[model samples]
Target: MRKTFLHIKIIFCSLVVFSSLAQSASFDCSKASSDVEKKICNTPSLSKLDEQLSEVFKPLKKQRTFQVLESEWLENVRNTCESVECLEDAYNEQIGFLSPLPLPGASASNEVKILPADKIYAQSSRPWKTVELAGLPNGKDVVERFLISAEVISGILHVVAFEGHYDVPNSIYRGSLYEYIDRHPIVQPITYTIAKDIGFQGAFNLGNNEEGERYAGIMGGTFYYREKIARNQLRGMAYKVGSGTQPQETSLLLQQWSNTFENAKSGLLFQGDEVFGELKAYYPNTPGYETIAPVDRPEVGWNIFSPIWSKSRPVLYFKNGDETIWRANVVDKTLTKIVSASDQLVIKNPTPVDLNGREAVVYLEDYILKIAVAPE
Candidate 1:
């Protein structure tokens, strides 16, 4: 009963906050008539944010993208967000997008936020195939609709290919767990190579509060997918919502993949809601494995979405082969084949990096792409 009441109260408050349409960076609280206006007047955070946005809007108006966003865009977000938390999130996202890149020769901060190469959002891609699976195997076929796309988090780009299926629908059908698990759409990894010098510049704390911190350059090596290996070299910044400028950094702590190659006794994961997906999340638990795991896959390269962003439990890259790469747990060291492999493709000179959290990127076959793995 209490949970029900709390949910109701939350909705009420959300309604109370969106009852108005007039907004500005700085507004007269006394004259505030709408729920949004009143809340902004009462909330110090909102007021300060309004002031900041007011100042940012001036310079941002000159940009091409910002003009398209317009007042309706901002109003729609503010009005649609029912809770203060959601509202704040909407504001921050808007500001991030509206914030322009730094000018040439602009100064940057001395401190740098160094993430493992994997955490850095590098350019990535994956082979995509369409399939329709029964929500409950042999039960009913309703075209379980879903979409997969690359997303940027904390200023990093990530794309992960993963097997999709309905979770165990109920306990009565637990007897046929394996058969019910559909591993149809196999998610592959995006791979790329870094053969030369690499660099990471820090974010510039532009001398003024109005502009805020401009995203520093996120330097990624050559990015490509299977066929366009030579012509697909890609690098530079990938933003979640804003423009990222180059940062000032002396050096990047590199985790170089071994020129030497080795094979793992088994694949990284098996496809099942219970075990397979869970195991891939926390891979590379061993210390110093980051430098060693790159060469340990099925063949010449690694599969996509095998590596995570942490030092512990990183899945090495593998070359694609005629074998259907199976999923396995690191503890028991057992492997399960979701689908049979064809003699078409093989893994090759695989390279990988952590794209922050559980997502990682692998470069192979002269192309680059993203993969899903354990979260950070």
Candidate 2:
């Protein structure tokens, strides 16, 4: 009888320890003082989520900007949650943003194809040599969507494309950003959520200022968002441009006016006012302001959305209509059609980059991304 009683006591102690461990969170459960902390300690699922978040957020804490943002999220989002559901949603959203999702058709086994001269439409004397970079897998939902932006920085190809799934009842759409290095499988940098109502407006560009700090500008209809890109990760939360009674209109107007410039070396340049028409520059890093001389604008018919500036020449490339890509000589203000494709396959978002010693341009033809090297 004594031995049986001792065994029963041991079992009881084991159960008590297990229960306490199950209820513990990333922090000490005994020291939990606030309501949110107490709630997290008491609930098993919340405890597990808190532990998981702690693990994921551990490495990112080294980044000072991320540390600041994490504190802000804890106070603003997590602390504000009154119920378990809200807390769960907040945790999941944060985890998703921190973790990257695999790009839809980024496969290592895919081969790059070279196109013959007849397949490319360009001037006879200056025929563009083209090669297929990567393409989406054959699917119905990915048919209509196109690549949004591409930029080559320090020999790495950075691309952003529109990804969507069309279902009868619930459709989803978002932008996917990835990098291609040395023809390897595309690496997904990060995943982010877009506002449901506004959505991504198919305009994204990455540029560097004179200081060599990289910045990304994305247009989501009424609002144009800007954020810094550091260590191949989006550093912090994106902020909207413009303010006033009609902020949305101002945002788009500012974005459109800035597209006239070739690069963001001096930051985003836009016209100050319609009456004065003086050019102004806004540096996002310092939030500083300055005035500059006006730039030569392309003729009225050119679509000035996300034009890629040539690093070697005074030329800028932009998409015109559904089938044409035009190169503008900023010195002479002459527009030349450098690429033309079938109406069924839209030519969009021309990006210029120097590959080794050769100058090349990358653009989206339908769902496939193709790079064309300028003739030597």
Whose lDDT is greatest here? 2
Q: Which lDDT tens digits does candidate 2 get at residues 83-144? A: 99899988887765544333222212112122232332222224455556666442554434
- Candidate 1 regions with alpha-carbon error over 4 angstroms: 1-25, 28-31, 70-72, 103-376
Ten contiguous residues minimizing lDDT sum, candidate 1? 171-180
Which candidate comes out best when scored by TM-score?
2
Candidate 1's TM-score: 0.24
**Candidate 2 deviant stretches above 4 angstroms:** 1-125, 143-149, 165-175, 182-259, 262-306, 332-334, 342-344
Model 1 over residues 196-242: C-alpha lDDT tens digits?
11221111211111112322322242111111112232233232222
TM-score per candidate, chains pooled: 0.24, 0.37
| Pairs of residues clashing in candidate 2 | none
In angstroms, the error of model 2 at 360 is 2.0
